[model samples]
Target: MLYQIISFVLEVATSLFGGACLLRLYMQHQRVPFGNPVGRFVFALTDGLVLHLRRVVPSTGRWDMASLVGAYLLKLTQFGLLWLLAGGLAAVGWVPLLAVFGLVQMAISGLTGLLIVYAILSWTQAGSPLSAVIDRLCAPFLAPFRRILPLVGGIDLSPLVLLVVLQVAAMVLASLQQSMLR
Candidate 1:
């Protein structure tokens, strides 16, 4: 029970911090001002870690290395706590399949976050700074789809396509992880 609680808290922290870091980095890329309250809050929450990482991980071309590193580290920490919890379950003769399950859960969470951002961008017509940030963050993922789909009747379907793709990826990852556990 204690292990489960610890793992849950760790997962929440990792997701929130990592998501904020990613959003901030995307906003920077989109040239959105960080002077606003939302921007300031995100900066305050992640600046310390991102600033430290900036020295070691310089930006490569257009990519924000610090943000990627922060997200990866957050995922790693979440995975670690999950592994620990799985081990605890195994000790009690519970199913030893939880580690893989935890991984799938984390991946799904990440994909869901991306989808939410994409949805907000599409719905708001990219008006809000948050929407602009999301647009930038999702550009790499949506670029190919946009080229293929294009805008029909002035309605962009890229968001729909992207959401479907994300869902499929999440499902595939979950299936693969479950298979590994078996």
Candidate 2:
């Protein structure tokens, strides 16, 4: 029970911080303006780690490599700590692979979350300021799917399709993570 609780808290904290880093990277790639509420919130949440990393990890073209590295580092730390807590020092060699697996899981989960919020906001508050930011963030990911999948009765099903695809990706990631345990 104690281990489970600790694991839960660690997961939540790492996911939020790491997710923020991934979001910052994506936003930068999309050339998203940081003046909006979503941008400000993400900046505030991730600035401390990201700013420090920026000193060492310079951007490549439009990509914010610092943010990506920061997120991966967070996952690595989280898994390393968890391994220590579980008294599994012998398996330390697998930390890097686990961290890489964690990063991919985080990315899929984060996109699924953003798409959910975007879908809800599109229905509830179509003209809200926040909606525009969500749309922009989601547009690049959803574009190819949108072109491939036809809308049904004026309702865009791209998000739903994307969500399903992400879930499948998450399942595959889970299998990879489990394989590392053996």
Poorest stretch of ten by lDDT in candidate 2: 173-182
Please give the lDDT score at residue 178 for candidate 1.
Answer: 65
> Model 2: per-residue lDDT, tens digit, 1-182?
98889889989999999999999999999999999998998999999999999999999999999999999999999889889989989979988888999999999999999999999999999999899999999998899999999989999999999999999999988987798687
**Per-prediction TM-score to the true structure, in the order listed:** 0.67, 0.96
Global fold similarity of model 2 (TM-score): 0.96
Which regions in candidate 1 have their CA more than 4 angstroms from the true location?
28-32, 36-38, 85-111, 114-129, 150-154, 180-182
Question: What is the TM-score (0 to 1) of candidate 1?
Answer: 0.67
| Residue pairs with backbone atoms closer than 3 Å in model 2 (clashes) | none
**Poorly placed runs, candidate 2 (over 4 Å):** none
